[model samples]
Target: MDSEVAREQALDAAEKLFYGRGVQAVGMDAVRTASGLSLKRLYQLFPAKEELVVAYLERRDLRWRGRIAEHVERHDDPQERIPAVFDWLEEWFGEADFRGCAWINSYGELGATSERVVAQVRAHKRAFRDYLAGLVTDAGLADVLAGQLFLLAEGAMVTAGITGSAEPAAEAREAARSLSRAN
Candidate 1:
């Protein structure tokens, strides 16, 4: 196969394996098997397992943010857009394969040992926070409200992941509504 095709296939496999199983638990051999690529081709595409992990994370980050943005964009009201984010989260959390935030899960597994993984996690989080800040600003809310909303969303993700329920997203949405009103 061509380089691009091979690389995408490898990444597809990596995402499934790493996200379904913890990054640390899934090995390169598993990725190669899942991708249907030869060991040598897999290595050529991803020089190391860490490189593959980073690529998986980068791709997931774009898709995850895009999904939330798409859902938020459905709201005509700026204030409503903020809570729409939680609505998207609730939908995602309801997925049968839902395993919580990919970045957070990867960070828990690899952040302490891998600087590259740590960087990816931080970048995803910063981008998310900045997105929330923009939403708050668009709604004529104080900058601090963005931070508060960010914390609420993050906490909800953690709670939902741990409890394996979508209740946290609804709870966070209500809290966000209350905070927006106060602001």
Candidate 2:
């Protein structure tokens, strides 16, 4: 296959194995086998597992972040904004392959060992926080409250991941609605 196709294939395999199985458990050979690509080809594309991991995080982020930005723009009411996030979560977590947030699960599976993956995860977390900050700013919300809501949403995601259930998302929505009304 061409370099582009090989890279994408590698990324696909890496993302599933790395996220579902954990970065440490899924070796480069496994990714190669999963992608039906040779070891040399995989190395040509990624150079290192770190590079492949960075690609995996980028791929996941691009998919979710774009959708999130679209959802955020779909409504003008700031009150409607926070709930859009939970709505997206409910829909995604309801998927048959739902294994909770891939990012958080990967973090748990890797702990703080993989600097590259950890950095990628932190960047994604910042993106989420900034996304929430944007919504709060748009709505003229207090900075402190905005920070609280951001953390609350994050805590909810972590909870859902821990329990393999989305009840926390519903709880988050109810809490968000109440907060919205207060605003």
Candidate 3:
């Protein structure tokens, strides 16, 4: 297989295994098997499991944020766009393979042991918050409201992940509505 194709396959397998299971639980051999890449090729693509995990996270971050952006941008109203984010989350939480936030899961498992993992997690979170900040600004809401919404969304993700229900997204959306009004 072409190196880029092999790399994408490896990352796809890594995202599935790492997100569904945990970073530490899934081994590189499993990734190789899933990707149908030879061990040598897998190692050639990802020198270490950490490299694979980071690559998986980086790719996931783009896709995840892109999905949210697509959903939110569907709204013509900037104010409506804010709540649309929760709508996206609710849909995502309802997925059969719904696992918690990949970044959060990775951070919980490997943050202390791996600086690179920690960096990926932090960068993902910061980007998420910044995205919220942009939405809040565009909606003419106070800057502080962005932080409040960010916390609400983050809390909702954790709750939905743990309870395996989409209820938290609805709950968070209501709270966000109330908060937006207050602002």
lDDT of 3 by residue, 1-183 (tens): 789999999998888888898989999889989999999999999999999988999999999999999999999999998899999999999999999899999999998999999999999999999999999999999999999999999999999999999999999999999999998
In candidate 1, position 46 carries an lDDT of 89
- Candidates 2 and 3: which is better by lDDT? 3
Q: Write the per-residue lDDT of candidate 1 for residues 9-97, one digit (tens) a residue.
A: 99999999888988989989999999999999999888999999999999999999999999999999998999999999999999998
Candidate 2 clashing pairs? none
RMSD of each candidate relative to the true structure? 0.7, 1.7, 0.6
For residues 88-166, could you state the per-residue lDDT of candidate 2 as single tens digits? 7767666666666767876776647788778888889888888888887788876665766777777777777667787
Instruction: Give the clashing residue pairs of candidate 3, or none.
Output: none
Off by over 4 Å in 3: none
On the 0 to 100 scale, the lDDT of residue 88 in model 1 is: 93
lDDT of 2: 0.80
lDDT of each: 0.94, 0.80, 0.94
